[model samples]
Target: MVGVPTAIAILAFEPPHGATALLALLLLAAAAAGFREPTPLWYIERGWAVLLAGGFAVSTALAPTRPILDRSLLTVAIAGATVAAMGAVRPELLVGLDWQVADQFERTLARYDFGWLGGPPAEAAVRQFAALWQALYPAMLVLASVSALAVTVYLLGRVRGEESALPPLGRFRFSEHLVWVLAAGLVLVALPVGAWADRAGGNIVTVMGGLYVLRGTAVLVWLGASVISSGWIIAAWTLAALVLYPVTMGATLVVGVSDTWLDLRSRLGVAGNKE
Candidate 1:
């Protein structure tokens, strides 16, 4: 009756983050339909409904002539802020998250290994790689939250009599202030705090690094869009990405971080392309 999209969205996350946070948000929003007296909760419910409605109605209805991002900036921005707040308030939430991912990765790698062909490349190597990936789990959570928030906000805007829609990928960008957060995370993990070092720093660095990758992806899309309009090109790129994603992510990370100082959008004329 109400909406099932929230369930679909929550499934994208691990049980820990999904069960606790996502359900809490859903229930809170539901409460607004009858239980809550506050007006803002109504906004949350209405927004959520529109979000679940696939955004088709409002996407075409509101500001159709304007840039898709004209209204979506607020939705995405709120998502970013929500992610930052969650990381700041529950830094330790990532502690269990990392271990869960590590354990899962280790199992998958071992299952796929052919003992005759390199014999899983030593348990130490496997564990090390798992640890490295685990360090990035917190950041992954933040990225997912941003996606959820963008959809939620867009839906909210659509139903609340405000015009909003999700924007094109190329419009995404991270704020400069986050550089300091990443720097602080790196500095903390760099210190001699034994077990605590990675935990403290990983939470910040991974989240920020994920943002950099997103920013770089936007840059890539912007650059590509300049000459390539064919959707098939995207399909081909994604097909190539399955095997080359690690390499692609590495390049994206480098380019994204570099943009902090290089002012890439302006240099590439992507800024002008948008406005």
Candidate 2:
């Protein structure tokens, strides 16, 4: 079941379609080989994974013109965010969102008759947007993908009998060594290197920094929950996110990176608590 989605992701990522397809086929075959007496839950999960993969393909097809990697990441980001949101609000709605998004995009694009607007200014704006997208979309995709997977695993555990399949969000953290990866990217970007090096560095920093931000949020949540009610925590987070978005995100990112060394969660005194 896991191989199914893993294979789908691999096939979507790179060039050399023939090679990727062959690799995916081999993975699927191996997964099939390991299949034993299947349970109803197994079929349900398999079907869900297939549906999600199909939706990703459809969404990718519907995406606006972009580099292959950008399009793939955008599709994954959109699908993952949609899935996560649906999971939080109404898990049952998860199945239809991808199709709906693709349909909506198709309809909107069909209605768009204008080729270009504002000439040079518009072109410049678009170039800027592309640069920003290249820098940030990797992070968005990483966060969204993890959220979607966590939701899936949580739901699976709820439906079937198992120990906790997902850990408490408050306890989330990545390996500390990942900070070095982010450092290397930042160094590359700062150095008087070529454009290719800067682009690669920007992507690496964006993705790894996003992970650290998540880790920082986990520490904050754990500490906040220790002293405050959930209602207050939610209220504070909402206010900070909506009214001071830049500040909030920056603080989280900084805190997250600092926590890599400080171990803030442990120092804060509720590090051992699961909830």
lDDT of 1 by residue, 1-275 (tens): 13333333333222555444566367446544554554443443354444433332233345445443333333334444554576589986445444555666777776755565556566567668767766665465445544554564455444434653555677666566668988999998899878777786887887778778877888777777876889999779868866899999998998888877887777877573341
Score candidate 1 by TM-score against the native.
0.54
lDDT of each: 0.59, 0.62
Maximum-lDDT candidate: 2
> Tens-digit lDDT track for model 2 on 205-243?
987777777777887777777778779767877687779
TM-score of each candidate structure, all chains considered together = 0.54, 0.54
Clashing pairs in 1: 47-156
